[model samples]
Target: MEESGNAIGFLENKTILITGSTGFLAKILLEKILRIQPNVKKLYLLLRATDETTAMQRFCNEVMGKDLFKVLKKKWGANLDRFISEKVSVVSSDISVSDMGLEDSTLVEEIKHNVQIIINLAATTKFNERYDVALGTNTLGAKHVVNFAKQCPNFKLLVHVSTAYISGEKEGFILETPHKLGESLNGTEGLNIEIEQKIIEQRLKQLKANGASEKDVTIAMKDLGIQRANQHGWPNTYVFTKAMGEMLINDLKHNLPLIIIRPTIVTSTYKEPFSGWIEGMRTIDNFIVGYAKGKLTFIPCDTNSIIDMIPADMVVNTIIATMMMHKLQPPYQTTIYHIGSSTRNPIKPGDLLRFTCQYFIKKPWFNGDGNAIKVKEITTFNNFASFHRYITIRYLIFLKVLELVNKASCNCLEDKYNDLKRKLNWVMRQVQLYRPYLFFNARKPKLSFRVILAKSLDLMTPT
Candidate 1:
């Protein structure tokens, strides 16, 4: 797996189709390609919209409109629009549906004939997503993407972006291995996709028959996802569905050139397109934001536990390099690449906490009252039980007092009580979703041959 040719050279005059164009990593990938390879033939973006016009609007507002594209905008300046218009095409499509929900036959035919690469990045990333939705988007959506790729006669490669957490909450050195169709991590029998779909349909019908409210339905669906995931030995719905998606792709992709990239805890950009650029709260970013705003004061996590993280730019680079390598030397079988820092440059939760404290001490965040919030060392609980006990003693008792006070005041403090209750529920939910990672016992993933080759070529860097 020697890197013989330049990645830039490989992209020249190549037409590529990218799904999830509005997502975080997808935007970074799009930016890198357009900025570095102006000569690339075409970039067809599949967006979820009612029509092409709406899709283009989403592309402008969500994708190019992001700060990630600032560097490219600065470089292209006045010619930016023109360059984009010539090189990029936005199509209205939904991966959750068959044929990616593409109704325009002309556009579909055009893509089938000209597109040489299809990168599937669309996914439902919620830890406790609805079973039906997660199944449709992450699992069945993968099948749809593969079916679409089959129509492209000249398709050189299909890069499926997935999470490394798809390995679930297993303890040990996780490997870059492909999942087999209908396989369950716990060795549970009868893990059929068709059966799962049927179960979802049956549950929905029952809910409808019982006149379940929307809220009830949502809660039931989320609970079902968690139940099914746990039954199959996964910790959450997102990873469970994603793992199924990989299985489907691996099984369906008979002769197609495919690469599955599992990136772990993707953080802010490290170098390319500028550093420290991040959008929305993602994984650890939530903690960072919560801490900075003086909202997060304590956490239940082992300070010594390794928190695998990789920069957005590095992940993008690995994707590009992997694409290039696959094109140059297509493998006989599908390749899996784990893009993470746990193995090479691991950082502990304590290290991150210390860094956050030091940074905030120097430049404190000012609240709405224009007062600089004083920084303090975060309280860490070694395990969930201790944290639960603390929450019960500290917050629950106070909540009970608030309830009594509200009753005495004749609903005068009702809003405050309700708000506090909601916040506590949110906190509990968040802790449940994040508990697996906080106490994860798995060693770093064993890098695959391709990842090793890419790193050796200096195409990917951990720092």
Candidate 2:
């Protein structure tokens, strides 16, 4: 196969099927493909919906309706809808199910015959997602995708988007390596997928027998996920299941062309489409939001620790370039790419804090009362022990006092005590979920030649 210098040429007249069309990365990928390669044969967006109508509606409202597509809309003007109608097709499918839960045989056959590339971006990103849900959607989900890929005679490549934290809480340089079946980060034994599934089933059955409420069931499941992950030496349920997903795909994808991309802490867009464009509060954004609202006074994090992060647009560009490269020069086996900026352009938590403070000071956040909220420097703790101590002394003690006072006053301050207690619990939970990243010590993920090549070609711009 001859190599082509132009990524646009590789995408020209090529049909691509993308799962998780409603996700942030998927939306950017979709917008980029249509913007750069309008001549592309077709875009098969596989969204989790009841039917094609609902899928199309979601594509319009959730995917294309975002400000990310403003550039394309400007260029296409009145013909944008017509262009999308001709080039895009929304398919209702679920990656967790076999055959992607495709009910329409005709649509399924058309996809199998036409799709040249399949990008598996569907996943449950919640760090503490339920064990059953995470296992089904993340681990077994990759297996189902590979099984479907085997049925596609025209399939050239399958790109599985995964997180770099799937490496777990490690301190040294992480390499671009495949996770062997049953491989555990901390060398735990008997990490069998079948046994794990059985464990989830047993737990659920016991909870159901006890007549657990919906909220209770959710809490139990979340706690079970964390317990299982800890038993297998992983930090959280999301990374543990994702690692298993890679293992399953590698074991089953015999001769299939596969590329696994592990991106670290994906942030807002650096450039392209627009700058500073972000969908929801994610990762460090949570801290920023809390601090801007004068709610966050302290956090558990190592200010000196480097946070490996890459812009959304850069990750999207790397995916496109990787796809083109793999299609042009097919690898002998599955290839892994770690898309992040830790090694090349690293930023410490302290730097991020300073930047946030500087920005908010110039333009302070306004309150509901139309008053500018005062900003203050936040206190950071390097370890959980110190943070816990501070929380107990500062907030928990105050809450205890309030509880005593309310009881003495015959529950007169009940509402205030309840509100304060609820806020404290919420903050503690958020900190616990984000503890891994906040004090992250991972040095950097070693980049592959393909990733270096993409960067060299300016496919991924430095921030």
Q: Pick the candidate with the highest TM-score.
A: 2
Model 1, span 62-172: residue lDDT tens:
998888888899989999999999999999998999999999998899999999999999988888999999999999999999988988988889999999998888877
Worst lDDT run of 10 residues, candidate 2, spans: 454-463
Candidate 2 Cα misplacement greater than 4 A, ranges:
1-3, 327-330, 411-416, 449-463
**Which whole-number lDDT from 0 to 100 does residue 343 have in model 2?**
82
Task: Please state the error at residue 254 of candidate 1 in Å.
Answer: 0.3
Position 111, candidate 1: lDDT = 95
User: Highest lDDT: which candidate?
Assistant: 1
Q: Relative to the true structure, how large is the alpha-carbon lDDT of every model? A: 0.87, 0.86
Q: Residue 437: error of model 2 in Å? A: 2.4
After superposing candidate 1 on the true structure, give the runs of residues whose Cα lies further than 4 Å from its correct spot.
Answer: 1-4, 328-331, 409-422, 449-463
Kindly list the per-residue Cα lDDT of model 2 for residues 1-463, writing each as its tens digit.
2236666667889889998889989998898888877888999999899988898889899998999899899989999999999999999988888888899998899999999899999998888998889998999889999999999998889999988888898887888888999989889899999899999899999999999998898899999999989888898999999999999999999989899999998899888777888888777787788788877768888999899998998888888877777754556468888888888789999998888888888889999999998887878888999999999999999999999999999999999999788767767878988877787878655555544455434643322
At residue 183, candidate 2 shows an lDDT of 86
**Per-prediction CA RMSD (Å):** 2.7, 2.3
